[model samples]
Target: MHSQNNDKKIIKKFNESESLVINEFDKSGIISFAQKDVSNSFLRGTSNDFIEESTLYWTMKFNKYANDFFKKLTSDKYNFNQGMLKVFKNDMYEENNSKNYLLINSADDIKEMTNCHLIPILKNIIHAPKEDMGLLAESLVHMTLLKRKFSIDQEETVGGAIVVVIISKSDGFIWKEKKQYYSNESNKHLEYVNYYKSQ
Candidate 1:
């Protein structure tokens, strides 16, 4: 979280830019001027409108922070080997209970994913189907950060890690610790990275 002074600075910057306006929303919290558009829209006045407005507002407000954090995190090791981003679909069935996983390992796929905008990536994860494992989308984003945090020597044991994001239907979104392990038979190591969800 940013300090009160920093928050004031951010507000001032936004005020100067005139691209958006932010103000407290009747003691609830600060809301963006863009939210007024949603409030007046015809989406049955549902919470979905609020969610979409909030997501867009915050994404716009904090996108630069996320990008700067990414840059600071990855500037030192541009050539490090990165783990593959994987998506899994969990089918809660009796007979065909096998978990199917999608391996996003192609060079083009990897490049596009790594370079894409963060907001859409997060929105996709947040709105993904129950079986689609959109919750795990964040793991892919964290892989870039983790690769820079941990040393190459430490990663050798895992041969590379697979980042998976998991979202629970009823519990809302939460972050969890990264899991790392090595497979002796395959001579590979895997780091399962995740965001730290508050308890």
Candidate 2:
């Protein structure tokens, strides 16, 4: 471990607060709209006191997914979509918990789909016309969402959140922390996709 410690001496000098943030991924997803329910106390503000459904974030996972989505988002030749993005007015979602599925299939729905890219996953929370909470961008989040879609046999969808990455002082990012962590370019791909971009 001595050699490992010696080689990573430069890491100590790297700025921890100097990390970069970008809004390109959300834009690239073409999620152009955001809706919120604020008449009641249902919509959890970013004060850390409320716990809404959270898609756990991490570094390696989010970056790779965001980077890939960014690439595809920029490529306009392909008509990418998040299938049917069920927009909810926070209060409407709360009142009709039993009928949540109703909000999903609107009369104006352009399509019916189970999967899309990462943009709607976020824009559903941080919509426009309000102060950007900047929460997701602030923290280094790595995640792997194990999807359990609802079937006729099962009436629930359980998405398991995993923070499978830890930002290393020595190595910038890794899938998981170990004795020796060196940044590998190829293995840097993050898996944040819930469903593949369906054709």
Please, what is the whole-model Cα lDDT of each candidate in the order they appear?
0.33, 0.28
lDDT of 1 by residue, 80-178 (tens): 322211111112121121221111122223324323432343345445664354333333234434544575644323225454434454533433333
Query: How does model 1 score by TM-score?
Result: 0.19
Q: What is the lDDT of residue 2 in candidate 1?
A: 22
The deviation in Å at residue 140 for candidate 1 is 3.7
Record all residue pairs in model 1 with backbone atoms less than 3 Å apart, i.e. clashing.
Answer: 135-165, 136-165, 158-189, 159-189, 161-191, 175-197
- Global CA lDDT computed for model 2: 0.28
Query: lDDT winner among the candidates?
Result: 1
Report the C-alpha lDDT of model 2 over 1-199, residue by residue, as the tens digit: 0122321232222211112211345442211111111111111222111211121122224435645655565466666552321222334334433332322232112111111223254456445421122233112111111112423544333344433443434435644424334434543542222124232
